[model samples]
Target chain A: MKNLLFFIFIHVSLFAHGVATGDQGYIQQINGINFVPFMYLGAKHMVTGYDHILFLVGVIFFLYRLRDIGIYVTLFAIGHSSTLIFGVFADIHINAYIIDAIIGLSVVYKALDNLGAYQQWFGMQPNTKITTLIFGLFHGFGLATKIIEFDMDPNGLLTNLIAFNVGVEIGQLLALSAILILISYWRKQPSFITYSYSTNIVLMILGFMLTGNQLIGYFNS
Target chain B: MFNAQQPTEKDLPTSAQLLKSTIIAILVTIILLVMVILPAEYGTDPTGVGKLLGLKEMGDIKMSLLEESQNELSQENNTSSIDSDSLDKAMVNNTINNDVVEITIEPGKAIEIKLEIKSGSLVQYEWKTIKGGLNYNLHGDGYKGSQKFISYKKGRMVQSDSGELQAEFDGYHGWFWRNREEFSVTVILQTSGDYIQIKQML
Candidate 1:
């Protein structure tokens, strides 16, 4: 429980300042380095990003093998990165709020899937891989909006965005390490099976918390 | 729920060890909450500037860039070639600046606000009234014809805290209001045909 509280405090602390999702204004162009600051900011944002963490929590909740976790995460990485790169480059803009709300919904979807809600209710399973790939696209586009928002310089945008994407991958690795460690250990304890349901329930609560906040901010604005 | 073996009794930590871990986690949580609720120490800090947190990204980060560069640069320049495109994207986004609230001291539209506030205030801080009810511009295109945030103050600010004094002020239609501080403020023009106005006091 303490560990859980500790993890949440870190997340809540980062988001309390500004919205947690990535966007342009989050990066400031200091000293005319232009996209460099954004690239650096992207690295930082991903390391501490809670929404990304939440999605990750759902993604890796059931995996027991490192290789399996890697495969799933890679799929997600490809999904978002492809969209993040192409979406901004193509100038396909969507309402950030709505996109974010959907991103929140993605979290909800994953948590529900973890709890086997889809099977109990839907009878037929949705294509998990396809859904992950699709949601990854939404997440990437979401960050791309922020990158686009930053008024990223074209001169080195490709380089910097690539750097940012790399940084995101790095951050994801680090975040996943901690999460995997926790989940792996929890699976050992006798209580692991008993608490799995509640853990995902907490994940659902966290997802709803995120969606609720974004919706309110969307409407208020 | 099968994975690597957890530290069992044979390899388990002592009773004191488990107790120590539990205590440490609790202590750490308390310390973090304090850091969050309290203000940062006086120093040049970039609460205004966010910390770059995304470090562990995909491998061969630079290689990916090289590959994409050729594909994209030849595909035609990216859409975000100009500052104007950014403004257009801003128009479609309808989220408040969840950072800090504001109250404009002027009587014109505020396009973008850049404010660096002193921290240590509750997330419940507000803009006191100085006149009639405060009115604000949500976000709109500025004279620059960009969808930059253009907001006027609206309604009044009410501060709810344990003991901090929440001053009441008469607000006009030109203030940005938020409780969280240590941020930059940007307001877009509320009306057309008028330039952004600035007052002596903010």
Candidate 2:
């Protein structure tokens, strides 16, 4: 339990929307379409992105069917890919801190939905699929703003963005596979039912932390 | 079952209870954000807990490094967008001259020499230490009241360095040398370029 808390703490503290410095330098220096490198960077960003992972975990927390998971994941991917490509191509530069804060709120929303808080509080269940897709859009904007900060070379930008999107999908698949396996294993235990409530509460807290951190950054910046 | 069993109505908490849980979550988030995240990441310690835990120092260093990088980015933008006509005019107005100056730094002492150069101007410089190696930083201060600082390069225990420096802004560009050895070190600095003036800063 202590180790788990420590892991979450580390993720929360280091949750700034930035590419690695070396990767950023490479992005700025390269002029033409560099398909493989950009794809690798995209995968790296997704695999290491705690905010995105947290949201994904929330979205799939109660999902027990593989088909449902596939549908939801596809919706998320489509939503994010549309915004990511369009946002970067049109140079729609939203403030990163603001977009990140919204992404954080998406995590909070999902965690609350998993806890059944909306049903109890508002007496109705919000459409989970729609919310997931919308939040995915915000997440893509967060990524787009970070990329814009690098001032990437315009040559072959579309092809590079497409490569990056494909890499993001690949990374999502890898991460989701691990998560699904772990959750499936855990579901066979009696403690899974007992501990589910507390787990969502912890997720909610992390969501709030991400939101608060980004807001502080927004104000300070 | 297609999914995890949904909680029955009887098992669900009351609306008030749900609100209470939310308030608790928010409270916990606020406490952690103020006590841990602010101090460890931003160096902002309001309740004094961060300093006690030795996290404020990390925050301070991160903030300074962020400032340094932002300054460098702005300097790069400034240099890249400099008007060629203005650069040419500045070069024509400033006569090219070679100057060699030698300064001695006693043990644990430091000295700085600055050249007044406009944005996009270029200068070639060579500096070598006569005795033991010294720590050196090549940096610049922005012109006027702009609170901009750019660090071009930094090195420790360097005996000699030769390079061409292009001004990123109209400012005082220079090298600061510090002798950490027990004995004094003399630095011979030779510079030739399009600059308005060169002087040792007191």
Candidate 3:
């Protein structure tokens, strides 16, 4: 419960800062040491992003082995990285809300996988590796959309991008580590097995919530 | 199908293996992602505006000799990408300022059409279940918030349930359907001359 409270606090605070008005033209002065700050910002965004964490949780939920986790995550990473770097670097203009809604649904997808919804409901197992990879591409594209919102300069593009990428990696590691710790401890409790089912249910609810919010936003205003 | 025998423990991953594999998976995924994204970032502009505006092939002994003169003007400004035709259009009609449209099309081919609105001047190309009638139809994007001339009825505005295609604007950009196929797009603006120039690339 304490952990849950802490998680909620982190989520609210992060969003308060991360959710900026959708004007892409706001130019802030980036210091010449471009790599560090941007990278830090990228990393911080990943670490503190609740939306990202929900998806990550779903990605790892069913995997009992590291190899499975690796394959799926790698697929996601590939999809996102390709789109993110390429999208922003290439300056592809995308709608922020629509992409985000898809991103929200990606979380639901993983949660559904965890719950064996596909197998039970449809009587088939989806190619988890491929789906993750495809969804990862969408996720990466969303990130790219956010980054492109910044009027990035041509100078030191590689270095700065590298820094930001590294920051993301660090943030992912941190978030994953914390999740591992919590889940590991939870797994020891009597309710762990029962909670596993609930975990996915909650995840799915959150995904629906996210998607619903984005869509309503799309139509409204 | 009620009760099948469960798999044995020998089939499941050992705890040690699980831990090792998870760590390695995270590392491998991150490395591969970065590797894929980095190169595409450093390369050409993804927005492809320069293509839409015909900036790259500006200075040729083509059509009106506007290309050569525009190239000289663009060179003075250190801009390697700005269409000569687009400049002329801008001088004539500037509906939206500070917007440049780049289009990719086959050489020496540009579509010309004049649009006259009986009601309001917004025009859109949309899809219909009955082909021509407005029973169940998709609209927006190239339609530019234009009306379909439905008698005394406000143009229908409904959110999509099937996720058919997201709301789109601009003929060359946004979600569109020639026959119900979705294409992600990047639209640049020209705003004059020949109403709009559309270049579709998958």
Please report, as a value between 0 and 1, the fraction of native contacts recovered by candidate 3: 0.01
Best by DockQ: 2
State the C-alpha lDDT per candidate: 0.52, 0.74, 0.49
**Candidate 1 lDDT:** 0.52
Order the candidate numbers by TM-score, best to worst.
2, 1, 3
In model 1, where do residues sit more than 4 Å from their true spots? A1-39, B1-202
Q: What is the lDDT of residue A32 in candidate 2?
A: 62
Error of 1 at B176 (Å): 22
Which candidate wins on TM-score?
2
Q: Model 1, range A3-91, lDDT digits (tens) per residue?
A: 99677544432222121212321221111233434444565567667888899889888776567678889999999899989988998
Model 1 DockQ vs. reference: 0.03
Q: Put down candidate 3 lDDT per residue, B1-202, tens digits, no spaces.
A: 2111223456454567557757776786565334322222221223543233222122111211233223323342452133344435534663422223333222222221122111223333322222211111222222222311121111111122122222232222222211111222222222222233333221
Clashing residue pair totals per candidate (backbone < 3 A): 61, 0, 18
Tens-digit lDDT track of model 2 for A72-179: 999999889889988998889898888988888898888888877887888888888898889888888877887787567677888988888887897787678667
- In the order shown, the candidates' Cα RMSDs to the true structure are 18.8, 14.7, 18.8
TM-score of chain A of each: 0.82, 0.89, 0.82
lDDT of model 2 at position A221? 93
Query: Candidate 1 residues B1-202, lDDT tens each?
Result: 2222334445433456455655665675465234321211111123322222221111112222233333333332343353355335434642323333333333322122322111211112233333332222121222222223323222222232111211121111123333211233332222211121222111
- Order the candidate numbers by lDDT, best to worst: 2, 1, 3
Report the poorest 10 consecutive residues by lDDT, candidate 3 chain B.
B148-157
Q: Which candidate tops lDDT?
A: 2
Name the weakest run of 10 consecutive residues (lDDT summed) in model 2 chain A: A12-21
